[model samples]
Target chain A: MLIDWFTVVAQAINFLILVWLLKRFLYQPILDAIDAREQRIAQTLAEADAKKAAARLERDEFERKNRELDEQRQSMVSRMQDEVSGLRQKLLDDAQSAAERLQTKWHVNLQRQQQRLGEGISRRVQDEVFSITRKTILDLADDDLEASIINVFIGRLRQLDGEALANFVQALTAAEAAVRIRSAFELTDEQQTAIRQVLREIFPADAAVRFDCEPELIAGIELTAGGRRVAWSIEDYLKTLKDSLGDLVREQDSSQGTPTAESESLA
Target chain B: MQLSPDEQVFWQYGFIKLNATIVYTWGLMLVMALGSRFITRQLSTEHTRSRWQNLLEIIVTGIVKQMKEVGLSEPQRYLGFLGTLFLFIAVASLFTIFPGYQPPTGSLSTTAALALCVLVAVPLFGIQEQGVAGYLGSYIKPTILMLPFNLMSEVSRTLALAIRLFGNMMSGAMIVGILLAITPFVFPVVMTLLGLLTGMVQAYIFSILAAVYIAAATQGHQANPDLATNAPKAHSQTNGISHG
Candidate 1:
């Protein structure tokens, strides 16, 4: 009584149709959408992972290059330091050598200046000594200084002995011309006879004698025969005094260790 | 008052009469179909979606999960038959809050039709999973003498499924109707609320029982041994509820 066969059949068909309708409109589309969204999310995640890996690689490469650059800069700085040190040492050596050369040149110039000063002092001493000695000799003696000088020269000739006596005797004997006598002043006839008699007594019997006047002897007398002469003059004594003063200046310079201005000029 | 929607005839041509049961069933069907079509018209595959689409997906997936729990390997394959059963029954019961709305499920004809559909679907799905011979051989399981008992069990369980749903839905509607006459205001509203709760439970029980039968038919009961044992226990309990 509760069941209606016609209605049951109709409801069963209706339910079946609803099943088909829901499956088409609802389940299928919803399932597909979910699947699509999941796939899109997965793809995005994969791409993000790839980009992360690439970024890591790039960072590593950049760090490697930075390390290499630091090493290169360090080496360059060390090399530059080494070159600077070497250059500094070379400059120092060049400066030292230049200073030594300048000192040596200065020493040479100092030595040349000293030599010129010594030559000038020597010349002045010679002129002053010669003039003073001639004046003193003429003023101190009451007789003519030229006659006194002549007598002193004759006395030196008479005192000759040994080799000097032999050489003088041989020169007078071997004369090709007459033995000649010269004096700073003119001789009177009596004085010339006296000198000729002395020469005749010392020479061979065939030897001849002559007399002449010369003034360059500076208050002295000379006898000449066969290119040999016996003479005395104030010029010889002046030369001996100049040599003694030069030896005193050298000894003083050595004791002092360094050259004073006077000692350097003298040297 | 009519005890069932079947007695309320809208049109008749002898044995072929259009009744309240058929007319209300069509209305429910049309509403369900149109609602699904309208919501799914511009379904977005994007992250943001319509709230209705969300609601629908939740419902469909929930049904799928329940079927899966029943040991159905691929729940989507049986989704059309099983999901519609729950939706149709629940929707019919839910419309009871409206004045003068007669739920089609309160009629024995509609419940029987749903149960018959489950009966036919069980064999169809079993035959689809295993050949006809393999499916038929299951009746003679354990011995040849058990074949008659197995066939009787199948028919009885299908009868049980139909009558259980019909009794729960009809009793709730009938109790609300009888209470509305006696108390009129407060008691009938409370009973109606209670009827709604009972209707939802019956809808769940009916659909779940249908799924269990399908699972057993397809030989998937072995997959989840717990479900296998629990399903029959629930059947016996619900059978007690229906008898009372």
Candidate 2:
């Protein structure tokens, strides 16, 4: 027989045993290893993805912070520029005001110095004119001129009109002191007597008369009774010239749109 | 000249006997068990692995893939029985390159035992898949008049499985032995190489057929629709090779 019953039975049992052995050692372990390796690879990939996401988040945060910082710096720079410009404008205003004050002071000082110079010139000119007029009057003085001056004074007193003649008559009537006369030159006794007779004739009262000589009268004469006086002098005419000259200078200063202290006071 | 290794009995005691088929089968078993145990002892789950581990994994997975192709949806359930059958036959034929060796599959007893295992496994798996009544009812499928044919088919196919493998393996060994006697040279070597090819083909055909039978028993037409088209083709091809 080609087939042995015992061997067939033995081989079948052997085949079964081989199946068990292979299942235990071969299939289970290899399959398990492959599964494990696959799981590990999947986990590693997941971790890598998580790390990449975290890194991206961190990068975004850093960029945002950088943007914020840049914005802050720009704002600060803008604020600084604003402050600097404001300060510069302030300084310019302060300097301009200070310069204006100094210019005003300098201008005022120049005006005061010019005013002093003008006043000195006017005083010097007045003194020279008075000296020359006094010298000419002293040189030209004589008895005949003295008689004409007395007659002119008498004529001027007689020519007093309306309120002037009435005020003079009221003053002579109310006078407690003697009537006084003053002249640039000393009067002669006849001239004095003549002035006393004119005063008596004008007053028509019992009035005392007195006579005086004054150098500052400068070729003019004056009469007084109590506090009342009537006088005419070259100085009066010179005062008119000085007032007109001061007005002219004040008008010139006003036209120029800068009235100096002297011109302001003069106006 | 012995037509089967079973005839080469080493010892006998009444009804019990020892022979080259049993002994060579044990030797193959020992080699497989010990080699599997040694290589699998330090199995690495990492990417890098030993060439032996790689080779074993390829063979095991290849068997799994083949079972799946043959319409066994769950190949792992059948891997042990079907994979053992292939490895035993393939290893037995491969050892033929060694001098003074007779492959165990050349014995009708070993081939009969392997086919008996397949025959038993098919019903066992079918019963596991669909209860005992469901599996038994398949015998009378379509009509009760076909019951005898179905029973006979089961017995006959088991018998065919045994004879097909036995004839191919025994003939290859016999031809190589006879050629060695006549030429004692390169012709037998060439025949031996051709015998190896035949052995590998027989192993594939046997396991694929077993898987098909198991698939048919367990899932019937409910399984892969392509199984219906493929089963007859496999059956015809195997039949052609056996007849040839």
Top lDDT prediction, candidate number: 2
Report the lDDT tens digits of candidate 2 across residue range A140-195.
87778767777878887777777876777787777667888888888889878877
Query: TM-scores of all models?
Result: 0.70, 0.81
Give the residue spans of candidate 2 off by over 4 A: A91-159, A163-214, A222-230, A251-267, B68-73, B137-153, B237-244
Q: Could you tell me the interface RMSD of model 1?
A: 1.0
Candidate 2 local lDDT, B1-244, one digit each (tens): 9999999989999878889998998899899988998998988877788999899889988998989778788988888888988888899999999988999999999999999998899899999999898888877867899899889988998999999999999999999999999999899999999999999989988988988888888886444457756777888899898677
For the candidates in turn, chain A alone yields TM-scores of 0.59, 0.80
Over A1-267, each residue of candidate 1 has an lDDT whose tens digit, in order, gives 999999999999989998998889878877777677778778878899999899999999999999999999999999999999999999988987787667666666766566556657766776677778767754654346656676676677667767876777776666666777887667767667766766665554556767778755556678887777877866566667888867765655455435544543453
Which ten contiguous residues of candidate 1 chain B have the minimum total lDDT?
B219-228
Error of 2 at B219 (Å): 3.3
Cα lDDT for residue A142, model 1? Answer: 39
What DockQ number belongs to candidate 2?
0.69
Clashing pairs for model 1 are none
Interface RMSD of each: 1.0, 1.0
| lDDT at residue B164 of model 2 (Cα atoms) | 95
